[model samples]
Target chain A: MLYNAFLQAIREIKRNMMRSALTAIGIVIGIASVIAMVNIGKGASASITQSVSKLGSNNLLILPGQTRGGPGGASSFAKPFKPNDLNVLKSSINTLEAVSPVENTSMTVVYKDQNYRTNIKGVNNDYFTVQSLEVDLGRKFEKSELRTGQSACIVGKTVVKKLFAPDENVLGQKIRLKNFSCVIVGTLVEKGANTFGGDQDDLILVPTKMFQRRISGNNNIHMITVSVKKNIPLEEAKLQIDQVLRESRHIKANDEADFTILSFTTLLDTISQITAILTVMLGAVAAISLIVGGVGIMNIMLVSVTERTREIGIRMAVGAMAADILIQFLIESVVLSALGGIVGVLLGLAITYGVAIGLDIQLILDPSITVLSLLFSMLIGVIFGISPARKAANMNPIDALRYE
Target chain B: MIKLAGITKTYGSGEVATQVLKGIDLQIEKGEFVAIMGPSGSGKSTLLNILGALDVPTEGDYSFMDTNIRGLSKDQLALFRRNILGFVFQGFNLLKKTSALANVEMPLIYQGVSAKERHKRALEVLSSVGLQERVDYDPGQLSGGEQQRVAIARAIVTRPKVLIADEPTGNLDTKRSHEIMQLITGFNREGITVVMVTHEEEMAEYASRIIRLRDGMIEKDGHHAV
Candidate 1:
């Protein structure tokens, strides 16, 4: 019975092909936007994870202020950490692999005829080990150079490219900073763009003592990077670091520690949560359009019922049950929306493809979502189709036949 | 085999009440062609609707082959019409934009007939109505006579016990009306009971029994040998 209804529905749709296609455009756009929004959101979030993990997932960052709002920002007026906190964390945390104090400042470096702006990092060799970085063409800082505050520096690949010719031999070459000059003792290897698309190889590294004496003119360390051992869980290391930092900073028991401790995994979780919420929000907006599309279908279906009253009357006179009439109209709407779903899927994939390339993100097509959208479109038809179908089915045959 | 006892159909209530079929008691035997003739408001169409099980009489026991139609549910009444009766309208009410064969095949679709068998039966019935070559033609593409022929073919395709036609030739000219009457007569000869309502005297003569209605009651009923 349903199969025959489907056949009748197809014929009816074909009879009014133009009107049917036009009526389905609403569902097409609704499903299409839904698919595009979800897929693009997923691709962007996954891209973030990929880029962030590239910076080494086992590392934890300790900033000397509370994360005032969320994971990213810090309180600007908080006191800076001294080297004492770093020693305490190293002694207290058994899961520790390596730790390095990090101080940074951005300034322009000048080489004869060229000048380029870049960030300079103040750290020891432990910073490279924690970040899994290799200075492919350079040597590490000497113990005396690190301890005595000598004007020695290691330049990143970008700084080298901006300051000197491709093969001009950067070692022992002096580059001028804002108010002083430093001799480059090594040049670091190239690492590409980070997750947020900022260049990873765009900074110079100087010994911590020289950076404090010649640049910062203070003993304050702004941040610290800690790497956990391969088999260590981050929570255990974080607990010890928190304890040590709290004690060294003289925070009383039961008081909120005025420092923020962040791990790469925690940051990834926060970012994932943010992306999921964004996806749901975008999906909700798309769903509203779908509902509007459903309303459009209902409107058209009600009009169709009115227009086909005589037809319904004829079928009723020729041995059709009211259920038969109901099924016929219901099938018509389902067929219409399912067709829209198919077209929407193709259009959505086209949009996703175009935007993925344009935004330089990953292209991820979730097969289940495709199938779900198709089913959802059909469901929209049924949900919105019942009223009109009932109207057609409950028609008085005599009055219907007499309808002009 | 149709019977109607004390059938009363009234529209509205209170001061606006108008009874269409009042105290109608009629019986139609199998293989009989009965014509109902009356002026407008004589309740002829309402009586036909009751006979066809399209509407329930406000007060009546409508028994078709010993089954009470008034006792049937809405779907059951639809099934009663589907199984035992067929209808041909004055308008030729062949489903618009549908081919003659498909229109003829419609009743069998509800009867649960298989597609191939229904196709075969529709073609055979259309050919019997002298529309074999025009089976693929839609209602708009056919002349008045041809469209009525398709409607008749649809009415008889299910092999219904009674074929109910309400002014089957009202839209046709004299010659086309005669042609459609002859077609209905042919189906009656083949043992299908036909109940028709018409206003024309000439059309009434074609039926073996002619019943005339005045107001809501039968004024005269005459039966003759075919």
Candidate 2:
């Protein structure tokens, strides 16, 4: 009996193709937007995780002052890290693999006639080891150069491309920085764009003493990068670093510490949490359209029931039970919604693919979400189809037959 | 065989209340060709609806073949309609867009008959109605008389014991009306009980017995001389 009803429902839908398509429009848009939003959100989250991990997952950052609402904004009472602080962390912390003090300032770098404004980072030899940076060409700064604060510097891939011709040997080439000249001793390997939209390769690296004496004229370091030893949990290393910094800076037990310790894992967690919330919010907004689509189905079904009163009467007189009529209409609605869901899925996947390619992120199609959206759309059909089906089933055959 | 006692049907309530079927009593025997005739506003159609089990009486005892039909549930009534009763309407209520063969096969579908058996039986009935060449034609493609024949084929496809027809020839011309009456009388002679409602005296003349209703009450009941 149900099979016959199903076949009849299909025939009815085909007979009123235009009306059926119009009725399904709401479901189509609802499911499509939901799929697109969730898929794009997932891709973005994956990209964030990848970029965060690329920056060395186990590395920890120690800022000179407490982190405020904005980056690099220190409190008036906070103090900066000195060279002695770097030594203290290196010698005292057993979990530390390397410690490097860093100071940065943007400067115009000139080589021949080309000049590009880029960040200039000043650090010790330990900075390269801490950041996992390897020289792709030439060699790192010699110990004599670091001790004497000579005018030898290393350029990143972006600086090398911006300063010299393609075939020009970047090593041994001279670049000028604000009336000072230095020879490029090495060119660092490429590191793609960071999550913050900054080019990781757009910088030049100089010895700490050279930057302090020749550039910023300051002995204070802005931040410290610490590499935790392998097999050491980040929490243990963080605790040890916190204790050592607190005691070395003479912080009182009752006072809040002046410096903040940030780990890559912590950063990754914060970013993931933010993206997860955004994804859910977008999905919820899209779901509203699906619900509206369900309402549309109910509305159309009601109208259809009324329009087919005489037909319902005829079926009833032909010995069709109330349940048969009910099932027939219900199946029609479910088939409508299920069709809408399928089209929406295809559209959503297409939109996701477009967005992933446009944003240059990996396409992550979550199978569970795809299946879930399909099921959810069908559920919408049933939930909204019941009242209309019941109204049709409960109609009196006598009156229905007499209805014009 | 069917029996009805004190059947009353009222519509609405309070100030708007109106009674469509007043207290009435009637009996119909098997294999009897009975015709119910009445003017407009009479309760002939209402009585037919009640007899078909399409509506329940407000107060009555309805017994069909010794079973108390008044106590039957909705599903049971449906089963009774499916197995024992057939109906024809003035509008030739064959489903639109459906072929004559499929329309004839509808009652059997409700009876849960297998597809092959339904097809075979429907084809045989269509042939009996002289519509074998037009079995696959939709009702809209057929003339009013041909449509009525298809309706009759659908009505008897299940070999039902009783056929209830409401205005079987109201929409037909003189020749078609007589032809439809001939079909009804032929089925009656084959031992199928038929109860039909018609306003035309000429159509009622073809029945074995005629009952005239006025204001929801029977005014005349007699055998028609052949």
Best by DockQ: 1
**Candidate 2 chain A — worst ten consecutive residues by lDDT sum?**
A68-77
Model 2 Cα lDDT, one tens digit per residue, A1-404: 77777777888888889999999999999999999999999999999899889888889988877875434455536698777777789888888888888888899999999999999988878888888888899888888887777899899999888888899877888899998999999989998777778888998999888888898787877788888989999999988888888888889877888888888887788789999999999999999999999999999999999989988888888888888888888988988898999999999999999999998887999888889999998898889998999998999988888888
> Which lDDT tens digits does candidate 1 get at residues A1-404?
99998988888888888988888898999899999999999999999898788767988899878885466597657899897887888787778888988898999999899999999899988898897788777688889998898988888888888888886988988999988999988877888777577888899999888899989999888889989898888888888888888899999879998788888777788889999999999999999988888888899999999998988888887768888889899999999888888999999999999999999999998888889999999999999999999999999887887788
Position A163, candidate 1: lDDT: 82
Give the alpha-carbon lDDT of every model.
Answer: 0.89, 0.88
State which docking tier applies to candidate 1. Answer: high
**Tens-digit per-residue lDDT, B127-223, candidate 2:** 8888999999999999999999999999899898999999999899999999888998898899999999999998988888999988988889989
Record all residue pairs in model 2 with backbone atoms less than 3 Å apart, i.e. clashing.
none
Give candidate 2 regions above 4 Å deviation: A68-77, A166-170, A192-197, B14-16
TM-score of chain B of each: 0.98, 0.98
Interface RMSD of 1: 1.0
Q: Give the CAPRI rating of model 2.
A: medium
> What lDDT does candidate 2 reach at residue A231?
95
